[model samples]
Target: MSAAVTPAARVERWFFPLLPNSRIAVLRAAIYLFVVVDVLVMVNDVVPKASAPAEFYTPVALARLIHLPAPQENVVLALRAALVIGALVAATNRLPRLLGWPIAVGHLIWVLYGMSYGKVDHDHLALVVALFVLPTVGRSHPHDHRADERAGWALRCIQLAVVATYTLSVWAKIRYGGWDWPSGATLMWAVERRGTFLGEHLVHVPELLVLAQWVTVAAELAAPLVLVLRGRALGLAVGFYLSFHLITYAAISIHFLPLVVCWLAFAPLEKIGQRLETRPVSLRRGHLARRAAAGQAVAVVGHEAVQPVPDPAERRDA
Candidate 1:
């Protein structure tokens, strides 16, 4: 019998699974869409805050490191304009290399400038990586749905970033909240500060809050398993993760849409794209058999192709 696959081999496959460029392109489009939406709609409050008194400008680590100036009204307006316009241009994916890097840098600056007031969100970790990686990868084509290692590499980076976002969250709890975080003190504090309707009621159950704190740690730590999961297993993991975010939103006022979109890294988006791109049943019946025959011819050359369902007549002939 052949030797069993090693853990290293499994990890290699997990990070480097074959995926179509179209899927990567689709993911890029989705990420860009969310970035635009966040700047335009969701985080509109940040724009106004940029005009806050220079005394209110409290820079984060990155901003301090980069020595970003205090947000003057005109400066903030210019940065905001650049970020929004750059995001719009990048979303179109025309001249990605030209627009992508500037957009990525501008976005980081925009987020940092806004975050300078006080709070800094970690949700955009994967988004930052996604924007940078998109410019590096070759443009994905529609009809050319083939497995690409380069495309997979870019996606794998985002996947690792997403996983790190969760797994590393535990470290933050330990560092700041300390080992007693499971005692529900942090939850109590957070709820007291900004609890929503669900959080308000749940605050009464300290024991349940304690249980939830531990559960969050467990779930976040288990996030890396999404890489190893396949097919239905992956779908289940996706649902669980999505539900986790939804529950957080329902209970607390925190939103993680940036992180949520990054979970597309683990999704079978290529298959979804294939399904959506599928021709109509009647049209497919007429043309698919011919392509199937041609595919067989190409397969003899050891070229792989995505096969559609065979027509009833074609199936009967076979």
Candidate 2:
């Protein structure tokens, strides 16, 4: 007889779903790769910002609490070197705990160091949270698709962060911009300031920008629905958000690549890894089978050289 599941147990199950460790493995590699790219290309200003005047340095709250010093050129360079090298090594899935924890901590400080200069980008929320949680998954096999609660927990943390990015954006909009934010000329102002040619043209269509602002708010407000959506619905929801990011970038030249990368938490990326790992093995098997069919002599260890076995009909005739 089976015991009844308590409400707490059910909540636990939902929170720590038994997803495959392979998914974590794939997600880890992708995230670490993105970190290397991010430091090099997207947020490549840390070292340069170190060259800025000392008077301009204003540490964020966490930096202030920890008494972290303002970025120095030497320190920033060393941090960048360590972060890039560590991210590359960690992406290979070797010594996960040893490499991953430092990368996570180093990246947090790196972001703080960069944002200390005045401008702070919120797109990093999901990515930073992802780096911290990914280390908790430890080592996961690229070929092992077996369900693991630990991997699920780590992925759930990332997914939650992703959701929070959107939901919190709405809160900030309302809190800072007020209830009239959606109806206001916020999008129009952005278009007028930094928008691409497409965005500039789109703004001319009367009330279009206002409509877009409202739609953006409504979509973000419905962001929580992504957590509860399943199967095709979930895929569509993720797809929709991805499409939204692409469109946003196309129109405004602004992108959320960091947060976009973290969206892979909801994907079955384990399947991609599994398929890639098995492809070579499958090809080798096909090669051996083809050689055997041609009656080619094959050497067997601890046995004599042998020809392919005869078909059942051929054996009967003999």
Candidate 3:
């Protein structure tokens, strides 16, 4: 007579087979790329003009929000540097639990300081929400391969916020620009008025302009539903959103880091991590051989040797 395999054993066999892969490595690389690009763009835009007359900060706005006096230019610059360091740490998944929240908060403060210069835009709001919520989520360490439950929740929250941004924008367009938003020339005029890189060129191609306007409306209107779909569907939706942002960047010169970072939420980061762990040299050969020998020795006693389960989740977070 034989006993059935335990549920845990069955689960280990089905879901966590031992195999070498590079999914996590790829995802980590992607994250690093995004962070590096963001940092470069920020430096190019902010550093050269930091001391210019137009780059001044206003104290009244800070007092209105938190009832505290605004710091001087030197203090703000120091905080901005700290914020960049924190963002880099978070992107690398180094000391995530300890550094994530402070980095996020510091980013918010830095943005607020920038906004105090009599200039604010809708694109900046997404970053604020992302920074505010990132600290409450997962801790990425070198040894833990499994997704932290809190981190997963944090990603989900970020997704919801992204969806809301699109939904509200669509609503505003309809309310303020009217139902003719889909077919009307309002979006075209708005882009033209902005006079950004692609805006003038886009207006020159009437057919392309019409297509862009309609697609923007369609994408924003469907954003909520698009976010609800998981896995590959979500991936596609995120790609679409990325296209939207890229187009905006080209056309309107908008600087929205959160919209770009949101793409990470759609990526299969956990699966990527699992693949990376398995691709390295296997130290299990000797152990497996010894175990097999022991099993053969036990066979004489009328019992089979049970194989050990592969637990990828046990690996540390990268």
Candidate 4:
């Protein structure tokens, strides 16, 4: 007779399967790389805030808890330097936990410091989640052949965070904007405020703007499908989600690097990491072809494993 299933086991089965370390390793690299790029590229505008008058530095709740100093030039520069260097070291998978934990703290401080000047964004949710979780995952070698539950846990959590970003975005719209948001001239309002070159001309088209508003809401509502999808379905859904972001960016000139990078959690990153860490593509393909020709079993596993090919001679004899 079997015993009753425990809550822990259920959670493990559903959320934390054994996976190759390569996946999390890739995720780790991607998240940290994005952290560096995000600071230098996407969030660089916030650096100027450090030089603003002390009167303008209104810290957020987290900043208050930590009793952060006023955003001065030296402080911001120090934080930026630490973040860039920490992220680069962390991406190398060297002293991961030691480097990772501090990077997370630094990045959080970085985000809070950026927000201290007034403007804030919800886009950092995924990046923040990745930063905190990566340190918990510990060491995950790229060429590992065995499954790792710890690696799976971290990747899945990142994936869930990615899904929640889109899910909650629409929820916010509905919560704050109510039902009229979709039909309303939301696009027109946005276009009038900070519209890019493309959006400026489109603002005159009332019908198109209205259509875009509804489409935006509908697309966001579909974001939760990433949680339940797998295989080709998940791939297609992610592709569409990315396309939607691109379209919106073209129209509004907004970028969500954190959210975009988080989507890597859904990718077959182990296989990708393997390819990236191995020889050139042509040489790697030749190696695999030779292996196949020698009647040896060859298979690749990612989000799911491909069926191993059987030797032709064995099949013929059977």
Candidate 5:
């Protein structure tokens, strides 16, 4: 004897309930970190060279990846700035659902532009994917004190995207490099050949290199299981992924924002906020107390206010 549910009602019922209250806070923190990192990277790009040459702009590379026409100079500049600013705003949770799409799209454009310039770093690929997915989710707003309905959907999307990148990367290595990735010495060879920053140090230890290869395979193969794992299992899996990224950064000097973003996966946002709240209230009150003390009056409990103590010189004069 239940009444039929309307399409709108059904959608809302399914979507809203699945939304995690902590997701907004976690996502907001992630976005803020991302914005700071991105701004630093952009500053590195712009400050090093006042005018980037056409080759450095990488338009053709971008065009191939994004399937868009090569943007003119003015368009490229505008898009780059937009991506940085949009991400900053999005990170702060300002007009999230409304601004997310444009910011995401704009960041993609900026990523493409960078790739087109000359180098397409693999670390950047993960960031491109993260940016692509960020707009689709909801982040918590400090002002509103309410979770956005769409944020729940976005959280699922981000989780899937993280898994997909790992799965696809493994697939790519196998498809392009062949299934012998685990057994063969190809990974070690890659490390030895591309021994830039950390690679140079690792090349001396064959055992470390072998360990790295096996761990990489295991992490990639196990990535899909993250979605099913909950609580501690999920935390361990996320930690493994982070370790993988940390190793990669050390070995190759590659910076992967998605891996950093994936830190949110392990973070118990609610628990973090709860622990933060446990900090001594007196510490915070001390600031206000100091300010009040600076003024001429002191207010005691049950009393409105009392005038400041007169100086010894003033008392002597009186």
Candidate 6:
């Protein structure tokens, strides 16, 4: 009595599974909050770079295509303020498409302006993709756990972008450093330049660093496996990546926090909102139960006092 699924249907289902809208809501808030912090901390140089000479403003490819101008003091300041305000408003989930679209575009331009000088970071790829895709989901609420294809698609895009970020790193490494990248002194070189106290001590064990390099390359190459992994296997894979990032940061000061934030796409984030909404109700019920127990000696029935029926458990305890 069931309909058969076709190959195209299978592909569509893979790309767009039905996930809770609450996950989208949670992701939106987290991503927006990160944007606020990022503008202030990680990429704060946008306004400052406005003062840098026009000659140093070598626009990136996207900027050139969009005809984005060189950063000006007034323009950059306004863009920064707008970005912060837009992100704050969007986090509130009001007029999502209206605010989110501009925020995405503004963030792109903001990062483009920053990177134009030199040094384009790969970490923002997933985050930028998330910003664009999330808006397509329109409105989602933390308490709304309804399964939505929109939310699933958005999450899937972010997950793919995250996997691509890891997978592409391998490609880039192979392209630039050849097949022997894992056996090379790349990790050692990075440690020498920006290594922390831990990394400094780690340099003494050269073979361990080389082994770590091999593990990292192998892990990144296998990053796509996370998509097909289910249940505990999926959780373990995500944990492994998070642990790798943590260890990387401890060894060197570099932390791809933007990319790390996107990892929530893999989490059952709807539980957080659901628990928060239900906790107060559960507490109120408990409070009433305690009060009832305190006055269990008597009960009022039809405005007449009567002996209360004791619970079997209480009688057993007595």
Q: Tell me each candidate's RMSD, in Å, in order.
A: 7.7, 3.6, 12.3, 7.9, 6.8, 4.4
Which tens-of-lDDT digit does each residue in 189-276 have in candidate 1? Answer: 8888989999999999977877888888999999999877888988999899999999888887887999999999877667656666
lDDT of 4 by residue, 128-243 (tens): 98899888879876666468877878888888888888788899999989988988888888888888999989988989989888888887777777788889998999898888
- Return whichever of 3 and 6 wins on lDDT: 6
**Clash count (model 4, backbone only):** 0
- The sequence of per-residue lDDT tens digits that candidate 5 reaches over residues 1-318 is 998989999766544435445556656657645755664563235323225544454455447665765546667566666766766767766676677777667666555555565555454444555555555555453323345566555555556667777777778778877757665776468777665767877778777776667677778778878876888888887877888787787777554764567557435565555455546554555644665655645555443333455666767999
Off by over 4 Å in 5: 1-22, 39-67, 117-139, 142-149, 196-198, 205-208, 272-318
lDDT of each: 0.78, 0.89, 0.58, 0.83, 0.61, 0.91
lDDT of 2 at 49: 84
Candidate 5's C-alpha lDDT? 0.61
Backbone clash numbers for all candidates listed: 0, 0, 14, 0, 6, 0
225-254 per-residue lDDT for model 3 (tens digits): 865586788777788788778778788776
* Candidate 1 segments whose C-alpha is farther than 4 A from its true place: 1-16, 280-318
Model 1 is weakest, by summed lDDT over 10 consecutive residues, at: 297-306
Q: So what's the TM-score on candidate 6?
A: 0.91
Look at candidate 5 and tell me the lDDT of residue 154.
Answer: 54
Model 2: weakest 10-residue lDDT segment is 297-306
lDDT, residue 148, model 2: 91
Best model number under lDDT: 6
In model 5, which range of ten residues has the least summed lDDT? 42-51
Expressed as tens digits, the lDDT of each residue in 236-271 for candidate 2 is 999999998897887788899999999999999999
TM values, all candidates: 0.80, 0.91, 0.64, 0.82, 0.69, 0.91
Q: Using lDDT as the measure, name the better of candidate 4 and candidate 6.
A: 6
Off by over 4 Å in 6: 293-318
lDDT of 1: 0.78
